[model samples]
Target: MRAFTALINPIAGGGRATRHWAPVAARLATAGADVRVELTRSGEHARQEAQAAAGAGRVVIAVGGDGLVRDVAGGVVPGGGLMGIVPAGRGNDLALALRLPADPDSLAELLLGAEPRTIDAIEADRGTPGSQGTAAGGVIVPGNVYAGIDSVASEIINASRWLPALVAYRLAPVRAIAGWHPPVFTLTLDGVTSTLRAHTVVVGNSGRYGHGLHIVPPALVDDGLLHVMTVGAGPRRAVISFLRQAGHGGHVHRPEVEIRTAREVTIAADRPLPVGADGDGLGRLPITVRIRPGALRLIAPPPEAHAT
Candidate 1:
C-alpha cells in the first residue's frame, strides 16, 4: 500500500463521483491513505492514467462505477499491480456482485485490509485474429461469431423515461426491426457448435453483467474460464420468456439461452460486430475470448465478501 489516488469519473452516477469526492477523500485520508484525486476527461483516459502508474507501487482506487473500475483495473492486469474500486456509479455491478459494501466507510476499511489476489480476465481477438489487449492471448479465432454481433442481455439499467432499459428489454421486438438486425452467429465451446440469431452475446472475464444482473451466476473472476451467455432466437413471445429468465440470473436454463463455462470461446458472425467489454463497447466481432486465471492482483473486499 502506498499513496491513494482516486480516478474519479464525474459523469458516472449522475455526477456521484464529483459530489462525493470531498467526503470520500476525507475518509480515505483519515484512514491513513495519502489521498489524491484525478478526474477523467474522456473515454480511456482513466485507463491510460492508471496503466501508466501500474508498477509505481501505489494502490490506484478507481472511483465512479464498474465501467471506471474495469478501465482502471484493466491497466494493472498485464503488469500485476494492486487495484481497488470505490462504488460511485449507478450499478456498481462489480461491487454488488462481489458483495462489497455500497457505502464509502465500509469500502475504505475493505481497501485498507484487502489482501491482493489474482482475478480472472479474458483476451478477445478480431478480424484475422491477432491479439486482444492482455490477460490471456495465446489462441486464435474459432468460429463464425466474429463478423456479425449483437448483445443478448444487458443490465445497462440507465434511467430513460422514454424507453427505460429494463422495460425495453422486457419488450424487445422479435428482431431489431429498426432495420438493425443482428446477424445469425456461431459459437463453439469445447468443440460443440450452436447456431443462433440472437439478442446479444456477452463475453465475460468477470461474472458481473449490466446493472447487477449476474448473467453467469456461476462465473468466478479467478476461475480461468470465459462464461458466455447468449439470449435465444424467435418471436416476441419467446423473447419475452427469455427476458423473464434473464432477470432471474439463471437464463441459461432456457432452451433458447446458451451458457458455456469454457477456457476458450470462438465467436463468428456475418459482419464485423461490436463487443461490450465491462459495459464499454469495443471493436468488431469475430473475437476469440480466452481466460487468464488470477492474472491481475485485485484488492479484496472484506471477509463478508467471502461469506457472500
Candidate 2:
C-alpha cells in the first residue's frame, strides 16, 4: 500500500483542525487509504516530521492552514515529494489557489485518487553578511511573498491566531494600520531597478490571500511567472480604504497600486521591513524572490473545477 502521512496543526482554524482530524482520518482509513495522522506540536516540528515522511517516500499532507502548508512544503519541496493539503487553516490561500475542496472527506477522496501535477514555487533568499541587512534565513512561499505594510498586518493577524477568524480578520488590519508607516523601497525586477515610496510590495505565485482578497487577480500556479504588485505610500486613511476595495480586486485598479510580472524580484528598504508569505511572517528585507517553475507536484483540482 502507498503510504500517506498527514501533519495536522492542532490550532489551525481556531482549533477546527483538532476537532476535524479524527473524523477525517477515520474516513480516509475507511476508504482503504494507508494513512497515518500526526498532530504537529509546533512549526519546526511540523517541518521535521514532514521532511522525514517525504524522505521515506510517503505522500506528505498538510492538514491545516497556509502556515502549516508552508512548513510542509519546505520539507516536501527539497525531496521532490507529492503533496496534498487539507484546508483546515485560517487562510487557506494555497487551497483556494489550487481549487481544492474545503471539506476533509472530499480532500481525502482527492488524495486517494492520487492525481498529481507540477506547480511553480517561489524561492526567497536574503543577502549575506557585512551588510546593513539584519536577517539571513530564507523561505519558500507557495502562494505569495509580501513586504512592508502587508507584512506588518500579517504579523498582527498571526499574533491574534487564537481569535475567531472573522473577528480577527476584521480587527487585525485596523490595528496594523494604526502602527504602519510607508517605507522607501528599492525594487529590481528581472535586473531592472526602480525606486518607490511604497507601503507594500506583494510578489504572488498564486494571487488569492487574506481570506479571499484577490490581491493579484491574474496569478496562475502552473505559470512560469510571478506577479509583483507595489502598493504606493499613501495616507493611513487611503491605505485602509484601498484594503477595503481590495476585497473585490478593486485595489489593483487604483492609481497607487501597479501590477507587473517578472521571473525574479529583489526588494530592499531604507530600513529593515517585515516580510511574509501566505500570511506568516518569514523575516525582513532585503529579500530576493525567484520562481522555480514546476518545482513540486501537488494534488490539484480537476481542470473544470479549477479557479481561473
Candidate 3:
C-alpha cells in the first residue's frame, strides 16, 4: 500500500475543505492505504509539512483550494515527489484544469491506481527577499501567474471570502475595474522585448483562473511552454466586453487580445503593481516567470482528457 500524506487547510473556502475531506479520507482508509492527515495553519506551514512528508517518500495530497495546491507543490516538486489533489475550495481552478474527479470514490480509485503524469509549472521570481508562502525570492505556481488589473481583482476576491464563490468572483473584477487605469507594461519574452499599454498580462500553465475564466485559452500543463496573454488597453466598456467574451475564450479573437508561447517571460510595469499566482498575491511587478517543464508529477486524468 502506498503511504499518503494529506495537508489540509481547515479555513480554505470558509471551511469547505475540512467538510469535503471527510468522505475522501474515509474512502482512502477503506482501501487500506496508509494515510496521514495534517491540518495546515498557514501557507508556509503547508509547505513545510508537505516538504517533510515528501522527503519521507509519502505521496503528498493537497486537500484545499488552488492556493494550498500551489504551496504544497512548492514542497513536493523540489524533491521529485508525487502529489494528488482534492478540490475543496472556492476556486479549484488547477483541479478543474486537470479534469480531476470530484466524486470521492472515483477520486480515490484514480489516486490509488493512476500513474503519475509529469506536468509543467510556472516559477515566479519576485526579485526580492522571500515573503510568506515563498522560498528564497521565488514561488512555484501550479496554475497561472498574473499582473495588472487582474491582480487587483484577485485581492478583492480574496478579501471577500465570506461571500459566495460566484458572488465574489463575479463582483471583484467589476470593483477592480471601476477605479483602474491602463498601465504601460514592459514584457520580455524568451529574448525579445516589447512595450505595451495593457489591462493585464497572464502567464499560464493551466489557462484557467478567476474561477473558470479561460484567460489563456491555449495554455497546456504538459506543453513545456508558457502561454502569455496580453489584454491590451481599452476603454471601460471595451474591457467589460472583453471579460464577458472571455468566458468562452471569445475574447481571444478580439483585436486587443494577444496570445503567444514562450519558455521565459519577464514582466515589469511603470510603477509598482501587484502580482498574483494561482489565487494569492505574490508581490509587486518586475517579476520573472519561467516555465518549469515536468516539474510536477500529478495524479490526474489522461492526456486526452486534458486536451482543450
Candidate 4:
C-alpha cells in the first residue's frame, strides 16, 4: 500500500497551516489512504522529519510555505524521492509555477492520480571569498535563487508586525527600495566572469518569485539550465519602476535588464549581501549555483496541462 506523509510548518501563514492540514488529512483518511502528518518546530526539525518520511517510501508532501518547502526539498533531493507541495505560506511561487491546488478535495485527488515529473534543481555553494578549499556541501534550491534589494524586502516582510502578509508583500519592496542601493556584483557564468552594478540578481528555474512576479518568464523547470537575470544599476525610482513592470513580466525590455541562461553561475559582492532561495534566506553572497539535471521528482500535473 502507498503511504503519504505531510511535513507541515505549524507557524506558516501565521499558524494557518495547522488549520489547513486538518481537512486535507481528513479527506485522505475518508478516502482510505494511509496518511501521516508531522508539524515542524524548526528548520532542522522539518528537514529531519521529511528525510525519514521519504525513507519510508511515503510520498512526502510539504504542507506549508516556501521555507518549509525549501527545507523539505533539502531532505527529499538527497534520496531523489518523490515530493509534492501544498502552498500554505506567504509566497507560493513554486506552487504557482507548478499550478498546485490548495483546497483539500482537489489536492487529495491530484495526490492520488498525479505522476511525478523529473525536474532540474540548483545546487548553491556559499563559501568565503578567496577560499581555495571547496565546501563540503551546499543547499538544494528547488525554485529560484535571488539576492540584493529583494532580500532586503524579504527581511522587511519577515520583521513587519503592522501589515498582513499580502499587504506587506506589496509594500515591503517599496519601503526597501527607498533606502536600498545597488551592489557591485561579480558574476561568473559558465566559465566567463564579469562585474556589474545591479539592484538585484536572480537566477530562476521557474519564472516567478516575490509573490507571482514573473521576473523571468522564460524560465522552465524541466530545462537543464538556469536563468540569470540582472537589473543594472539605476536610479531608485527607475529600479522601483522596473520591479513594478516585472510583476507583469514587462521589465525584460528595459535596456538595463538582461535575461539569459546558463548551466553554472557564481556570484559575489564587494560586501556581504543577503541571499534568498525559494523565498527563504540562505545567508550571504559569494555563492556558486549549478543545475543538476532531473534532480527532483515532483508530483505535479503535466507541464502542458492547464491548471485546475
Candidate 2 lDDT, 64-134, residue by residue in tens: 89988988887787766888888888878888878887677787778878578888888887654422111
Please report, in order, the local distance difference test score of every candidate based on alpha carbons. Answer: 0.61, 0.81, 0.89, 0.83
Per-residue lDDT of 24 in model 4: 79
lDDT digits (tens) for residues 218-307 of candidate 1 = 666665677777765555455445545655676777776666677777777776666656655555566666766666676765323433
Which candidate, 1 or 4, would have the higher TM-score against the true structure?
4
- Model 2, runs deviating above 4 Å: 128-138, 303-308
lDDT of 1 at 47: 61
TM-score of each: 0.80, 0.92, 0.96, 0.93
Which sections of candidate 3 miss by over 4 Å?
A: 129-136, 305-308
**Candidate closest to the true structure, highest TM-score:** 3
Off by over 4 Å in 4: 128-136, 305-308
**Count of backbone collisions within predicted model 2:** 1
lDDT of 4 at 236: 87
**RMSD of each predicted structure:** 4.8, 3.4, 1.7, 3.4
- Scored by lDDT, model 4 comes in at 0.83
Q: How many residue pairs clash in all the candidates, one count each?
A: 21, 1, 0, 0
- Name every residue pair that clashes in candidate 2: 65-89
